[model samples]
Target: MLGTICRFWRDQRGIALILVTIMLPAIIGFALLAIDMSRANNLHNDVQKGADAFAIAAAAELDGAPDAWTRAERAMENLVDNTTRFSNSGLVTLASAGSVTVNPGASSCRSRGNISWCFLKSLPASDSSPITSSNYATTQAETLFVQVTVTPESFSSIFPASFLGGSNGLTVGATAVAGSPGAVVCDMVPVFICNPFPGQSLYEVANSGQFYKKSLKLVVGSTSWGPGNFGFLRPSDGHGYGETDLATDIAIGRVPECVSARRIYTQTGNLTTKVKAAFNTRFDIYANGGGFPSKSDPRWPPAPNVRKGFQYASNGNGQGSGSQNPCNMELATDATRYHQLTRDTSFTGQIGNGGWDYTGYAAANQMTSALTHFGSSYNNTTNPPSRYDLYHWENTHDSNGNVVPVGDPNSLVHTQSVGGETGVPACASTVGDEDRRLIYAAVVDCSDSYVQSQLNGQSGAPPAIGFASLFLTEAVTGDEVMAEIVDIAGSRGRGTMENFVRDDVQLYR
Candidate 1:
């Protein structure tokens, strides 16, 4: 049969040669078609990956995911004809009207389904798991698990099939599930204290909420006087001096304790206090809550009689002040509010571990020993207390295994160390302890505090470089409020992975 077809083609006498010639190329062409198909398959696979990445990114709210998908879709949208929705540039542009259509799982968890997809929500402030993490639900019941599905119809390379038929596009699908490592919920942030110093101890016993010192008329400086043991605690779980340090006075070294000491919060001459009940109602949405700030909770106005922040505080541009201004308290934004978050209820009843400044007390004791350094009259009791610099300290466990040492800010010497308090067992060891400085610590509750005999006792001391005061921002649920002590030198503080410490720390005995 093969010879008959070839013989007729050479003779050119029969129509068989023309049919044979045509069929010959057709057969060869079909084989080439298979080869091209293989190439197209490879292209299809590459495009699929791009499509998958794009789909997942679009489904989530990653920083630039939407725009990224736009550029990618532009590169491949035309290959599959104009019918590809995934390849639609309109859904990923500056004016994108795209919304993720979540096909909920059987139990409301998208993870249960085959097609899942997603993206990360912009910084969530709650102690909840990130929407992107797989263990989001395990961390908190508030976490919703959902599978995302996307159809990037533009990924198909239909043009290659034009030889056989015409363009016929393809569609791709993908999904993702959110989760967390463990249930987390600690919202009690202790930002301010009766005595604000880098290194000092406090006889801390309660896990009471931290008080507002600067915002109100309260104490900020720690004293190196008074009697009684002291205790200490920090939000990061770092332990410190947990001994009696005078009733409420902190000291750098031994000294004739003050006749009476206090932390000032107790003398409520003229301090401000908003009803927690009223403030708690901030979560309640107003009846007309439909502008840019969407409301997720129930609606209720300030009950007329309940009262809100001073009047309707307006925080214009956050440059000015408003009692209820969203700009001022951005930390409480509805989407991923960080302020109200606290550790899980399971751990709420507990206290926080305290930390100490290794060099604080060491330097204080050393200063007390000298009475005067480089020629100066040290008198911590009343007038001229010699100025000194306290710098450097290493972790040394206190009697209670509290690894904290109180030291003055900078290397400024304490008046007792430089003026008076000279001899004490702790002082002797601290003075000679070359690697560290002395520290003073004390504890006071809501209204307990002590101050320098004069607000500016040792004026010569260098100012605390950064924020001299601390204020605790209430924790919210669902996401974490990233706290970093990013000093110019990059000093790493205690309490977390890499570089995050709770803004406020609670302690339990």
Candidate 2:
């Protein structure tokens, strides 16, 4: 028996089982801790996603309206319905700051979760300070951003922390900041028009027909232009907009870069001569040189209704040789034959009294009366249909007065003139381009000190109060760009903005 006992004491057969039994409790404890940690991590991710979503939704409504904060709070309460996957899986409740008039830190809403938010004029260094109601109103236009913070979610951990002398609960918090980075307008022409009615907003004036349908001469001036003067703009794109590039943009309608409607970079030097050839391209007049595209190039096609005064040149003047394309050369001036729409008679320096030769124009173009063209709504004898109104009607209808599909080729409304010049475009058959005659321009408040300085050749980026859509009535004659301000760009509810103002929101942190 003594010999057997000695052998068993030294035996190692069950030693492995004994070791595993001793370490089993520790292994289970570690596994439980890891599971709890993973749950906490998952909860954190969900809360973070929720915060981001909440911030974005709320920020979209802070559009500088008097009721912006109120709208933001409503959006937050109604739009968000985030749920947590871990940590009891309850509906995430967000605390509301009651009314916009309520004190900054006094949130009347509180339940399962809590939320705190603040309006910021700019991105804050830290999210500790919140904006007051009065302060927000004072700086409403500047307060274009919002910061949001969610209270840490606290829940009981499955792992028994008693084993490690710790509490059996975990907490996770999240923060997000979101708002509009202002609005950006895209595909604008490289030109700026001085606001005609500086006393009132552009939208109000435009909607009220203060400038619409009235002819205005956009003159080219390097320095010290009067109240109604208009000029070119320098593209903010660092790719360098030379005379040639400027000419190309004038013809093609937009530069590669989109400029801010709030601020416009005025062209410093005289850009008058280079653009004449480019502007003539829309009227089916292509120059032989100056980097202008050839007549056959599809990219630089003319407007379908290129009804300029001069006809195709009978004698080439050594410029246009081919009979097939005698239209390339500029015909000699004939006061009797050359047909330019007569300017409005009651004219000031650059502005017209909205009374142009509508009767003669209708007779010349063979267009129907405003009553026949636009129906009974616009048959007022006092206010005749604008040239822009006629242009649209002419494009949509064919020679036989039948409705033609937008892309389909249609016969000219009137027979070609004896000199070969006509309203119909010979270079391009289709009028598919986006209103080739409608040019978008920034409307700057020339009365503003900065804008006045800019006009006087000072180095300053003047803020554009709005953008206007000017219809190119005639080709650029000398340094004057003649047009009628048919309407202002963008929606006219609040004010006229750029043609394409992209308003969006994003998460900052």
lDDT of 1 by residue, 386-444 (tens): 11111111122222323344332222222223222211211011122321111222223
lDDT of 2 by residue, 182-287 (tens): 4456777788877777666676686786777788877765666654677777765433557787777777778667776545677755645558877777777766
Best by TM-score: 2
Model number with the top lDDT: 2
Q: How displaced is residue 358 in candidate 1, in Å?
A: 21
Please estimate how well model 1 matches the true structure, expressed as its whole-model Cα lDDT. Answer: 0.25
Model 2, TM vs. native? 0.68
Worst 10 residues of 1 by lDDT: 262-271
